[model samples]
Target: MTEIKRPTWAISNPLMQQYYDTQWGIELHDERALFEMLCLETYQAGLSWQTVLNKRSAFEDAFHHYEIEQVAQMTETQIAPQLKNEKIIRNRLKLNATVNNARTIVKLHVAGRTFDDYIWQFVDYQPQRLVIQKDENLPAQTRLSVQVSKQMKKDGFKFVGPVTIYSYLLAVGVVNARLD
Candidate 1:
């Protein structure tokens, strides 16, 4: 049997290795999937990706599988219990922002725009691949991320700072920061 070689960031965990090889940087067109990643990135604001990946299933269960309309309808009353969920990150602010972000996505739908279209427009509907010469050269947050984060904030999306938005962009395949 042969072992697969993965990036250092993913090699530490089976889930991370799988996510990197199969899911990460793949173009995701589904609104639900996009919303899920965005929310996951939100929860990962102060944690590691490994932590979020480990709890992805719990999050999906708790947040209605990231269904835009369903999660958008999540009230504070409904979300109150998630703060105590031992399986998930259990951050009150991140949990609240999940619902808030879902509502914002719903508003986007109300305006006849799909969350997919609204997000892809920032890159002019193209997935960008960057040139990375080394790990040290990789960016935590780019100007583009800052721009998107600012616009998202203006549109009432919470927990979307530039660093988080950068990760979201990478996760959704709006930008491919995969190292060569």
Candidate 2:
């Protein structure tokens, strides 16, 4: 048997490893994927990323694959069932907030602004590469996350607290670790 070289966080978890190898920290440019990550980060509040990763499929199915338009169109009736869904995080507020956040993204698109457009401007349309020698030493939140979270809040995005946004930033490669 051989131990796979992986990020500290991805150790011993096939799903996390797959996410790390295939998705985590990868520079994502698509609006839909970005939106999906943002929503998942919120659901991750007070929970481990591994827990959320495990439920990613359920989240996708419950939220209509996180399509901004489709999710935005969801209502109490649509979201009510998901609150009782065993496969997904069962927090009603968080679930409703997901729909609300989707609606916010839809509003942005209606205003000729894409979620990617609003988020990327924070870094001048460039990824902020980080030189972290130890992932354990990374701050729970950063100045950039604080600033971005505030702006997203003003723009009516829910569940975008600083720490959550920081995680989102890292997951989407808005904040990337220096490979060298």
Candidate 3:
């Protein structure tokens, strides 16, 4: 029997290994999960995904398990306390953006759309699966990510630049990662 070793980025420990093997690159249709990923990705700016993954549980707890409605209604002062908690990323901008982004999601819901609907629209509501010949060659930003990031910003989302959106798209499986 042979053991399948994961990529270094994916197998530093149990949590990352589990997340990479079970969830990474899998299409996520749930609105709440999509929202959560968006917030996490925003927090992941300039940081390693493993750092964010390690704090995922604390983040979930701080953000009320990312309950869209609950987080949507959280005020800055309400979330400010989290800055002092060492369990999660403590950046003020990212934390505020998380709440603000939740509000945007709720607004979309009011408009009769879910975050899931809004995001998948960029890809025509289908996952853009790609064959990966070389993992290192995967682009930092793509045309689709650019278009989606522009639209999202116009629609009032924060922390959603092209690079971040590209990462977000990949996380939620709008873009499939078949790295070889």
lDDT of 3 by residue, 10-36 (tens): 667888888877777789999889989
Clashing pairs in 3: none
On TM-score, the stronger of 2 and 3 is: 2
Candidate 2 steric clashes: 0
lDDT, candidate 2, 38-66, per-residue tens: 98999999999889988999999999898
**lDDT comparing candidate 3 with the true structure:** 0.87
Q: Please give the distance, in angstroms, between residue 114's alpha carbon in candidate 1 and its true position after superposition.
A: 0.5
Ranking by lDDT: 1, 2, 3
Give lDDT tens digits, candidate 1, residues 2-43: 554445786777788899877877788999899999999999
Full-model lDDT for every candidate: 0.89, 0.88, 0.87
lDDT of 3 at 45: 94
- Alpha-carbon shift of residue 111 in model 2 (angstroms): 1.0
Per-prediction TM-score: 0.93, 0.94, 0.92
